[model samples]
Target: MKRRKPRILTLYVTERCQARCSFCRIWEKGNPKDAAPAHFKALLTEARRLFGRIFVDFTGGEPLLYEPLPLLLKQAKEAGLRTSVTTNTKLYRQRAEELKGKIDYLLFSLDGTREYHDQNRGISLYDTVIDSIETARRLGEWPDLLMTVTRENIKMIPHVASIANHYKLIFQINPVFSYFGNTGLTEQDVKMMKEYIAYHKTYVNYAQLRLISRGGNSTLQPSCRAVTSQIVIDPQGRMLLPCYHHALDRLDTEGSLKKAFDSTLRRWYEKRQGTFDFCEGCTINCYFDPSFEYMRNQAALLSLSCRAKYAWLRYVERPIEEAFKNRKRGEL
Candidate 1:
């Protein structure tokens, strides 16, 4: 077997969020302290040594609350790393110009239409987010949109996709999983989502489309990649061993980050990464998507087939639509 290393790093820079989403646990305990930029730079440096150039996402309860975001973004870019920031877009209207061209991609959160979004997010900032999207467009910034699918908001997926289309931004639908206390979406809901995604693939840019499903165990499973190809670090820079949603034991990173990676805690995770006792057939896209590239077993093939139809539309139909739009606009 070949060894694999981290390809993407998800940094939860802060536990401070602007809105209190009912389905999220960002504010469950209390307002946590934000990590210093130097801490992040160190992580990036170590990560690069282990896994060459990789993609980094600065996520948070609300990353915008981290005052030194611009500095961190600049540092990541200077390190020759591709970077992205995920925010609720509540502060976008105020900091549009400041964050115009800092990162490679900006992801905005939107659960559903104004009413549904406000209801789920526990805040009524939908209008502000829409306004911020406009501000990003005016500044020539194309921001992606993320909508976590829940039972209440499942049917609204297409409506949200329409909104993403209006802004010409990439859109993603991530199914809320049991890890978040069960998103309440049934098998029927997943079916509806598959159908809707296929229909939209004709008009949406495949490069900008994302469809994330629930995680759990089954026969069609691949080796989990939580601590391997994908890693999640909390605000304090402690590694969430095994996976992010369920941290078995926190790996200490106070001294050398590489030491923690090669510690007994990591070895424990590696031994039980894909076993039913540890991850329980989880299917989180960020960790599992890479498995498709090196699929060698029956489980990998089944996993790929489950989402292959939509994947086809995304890769095939999306490019054709993009070409049509470009020609229509005289850009081709």
Candidate 2:
């Protein structure tokens, strides 16, 4: 039997954003045009036909900005794709009802404490996000938080975790990527981040294990599974980036999703073994290079086990697990 490819489809609904976060990579002013509904439907059709268990993640400067998101998600679900989104939680309350059941999980971006968060994001956003999460909780949406720690917000990780725990929410702490548009941290900041990671390894490990055990897919697994498994469609519908960051770089595209995907994978495979000037000691989880070492050693059965464990966890124990954690922490 032929090996199955690991496939995930990400749609950046729009380039428009409301926040002026200092570290944001994709944020842009104004309502940049997005792919038309017809184009998205065509892409979805092709995606469903090609991959088994297709996973779709809708992203953007803020995906909620696209008024037609609920309609898109409804179509994706009807087509048999499990869907997710990464949003800032600003529009979450107003959109939660439309999003219910349509999305499997919501990846809400929350950096840190009010002062720290507002500093990184924009003024007064901290309260807005907290309120959004509170509303989601009341509505039983139960979204997970994606907290990216950077030089400015590294000091407040414990606080961030506490907030997640307090709200009975699962959170992933991702270190900020050193993107071209990033403000660029100093050596001291890098060291601080390393120390933070070392200190929080226990939390990070638990979160990752739980996510995998719950059948959640991560593109960061140091395996080349993405080459065979994942596909990313940008806003234009003409280019398919191998990963999110590459899409942001605006690399060459072949006009069609199939051709663009094939070309991107070929180029990636050719350069997989080569080191670039920018490849030195990076720790971005979403990148393929860091995951290569683990991917190389991972066995097929082990991979399947991980997936199975995730499914089992997601089905049986995830809800109570968070409550249990809260109880342990004396929050409940």
Candidate 3:
């Protein structure tokens, strides 16, 4: 019997965003066209049929702005898929209750401290996002904090980890990818990343060590998974994205997800030496790094260990007051 793929399906419900962040290539212009409810229903049906453990992530300029988000999530859950959303958290509070059971995880994009966050996202967004996260925690939603490490906020890494610890939250540290439309990193920005990596090496390494020691794996690693296990469907339902950055660069559809997985993608992964011009100079976590690891299984053990450690921490060491304080301080 053939092994089923471990697939993650992401839907860009809308392109309408309220914040004008400098780093975002996709949300630079508002996405006026959205996937209608009927189309979404069809996509969900296809997702349920094609993969085992269907994981759905609804994203957008702001997915919450999509009028039928709650309904879409409800349908996904009803189909028995693990559902998540990546949002700026500006509309979290208003939709928390409705999303309580439907969403398995709320991945909030939190950059840094209030001043730093507001500067990167928009005016007062940091506070609003913090408040929304706190509320979600209080309501038992257990949201995960996703920090995109950019040149502007790299210095605050330790502080961010401290906040995650305080909030009893699982943190995903993503190095910012330079894409078209976003200002490419300067020498100073590169320098800042190096400094940030050096400064927080202890905490970052320790956390990773602990995670590995406990058997936790990072979902972000092992990049060929996108070709084999993950499928990103844009607002227009175009499939087989090289990466989110690629998808945003143009809503180009190369082939159906099924065809890609069964044909060219399979050949690339199986052969283990193929390269795409698009893969060069790419830093998007959704692709480049994972491809390298998948080819060699370089960090599998550490990844599994880290995941285990995280589970242990979640069950045994998660704190309450600290969690709230972390949010209040904009550390998370």
Q: Which is the leading candidate under TM-score?
A: 1
Instruction: List the candidates' TM-scores in order.
Output: 0.82, 0.74, 0.74
- What TM-score, to 2 decimals, does candidate 2 have? 0.74
Report the C-alpha lDDT of model 1 over 183-224, residue by residue, as the tens digit: 545566666766777324322211112223233444345356
Residue lDDT tens for model 2, 198-245: 322112422222222332333343333333445555677654433555
Instruction: Choose 2 or 3, whichever is better by TM-score.
Output: 3
- lDDT value, candidate 3, whole model: 0.63
lDDT: worst 10-residue window of model 2: 199-208
The candidate with the higher lDDT, 2 or 3, is 3
* Two-way lDDT contest, 1 vs 3, winner: 1
Write down the RMSD of candidate 1 (Cα, Å): 4.5
Q: Where does candidate 1 have its weakest 10-residue lDDT segment?
A: 202-211
The TM-score-based order of candidates, best leading, equals 1, 3, 2
Regions of candidate 3 where Cα sits further than 4 Å from its true position: 1-6, 181-225, 247-274, 288-296, 315-332
Instruction: Show where candidate 1 strays beyond 4 Å.
Output: 198-215, 219-223, 276-278, 281-285, 290-294, 297-332
The lDDT leader among the candidates is 1
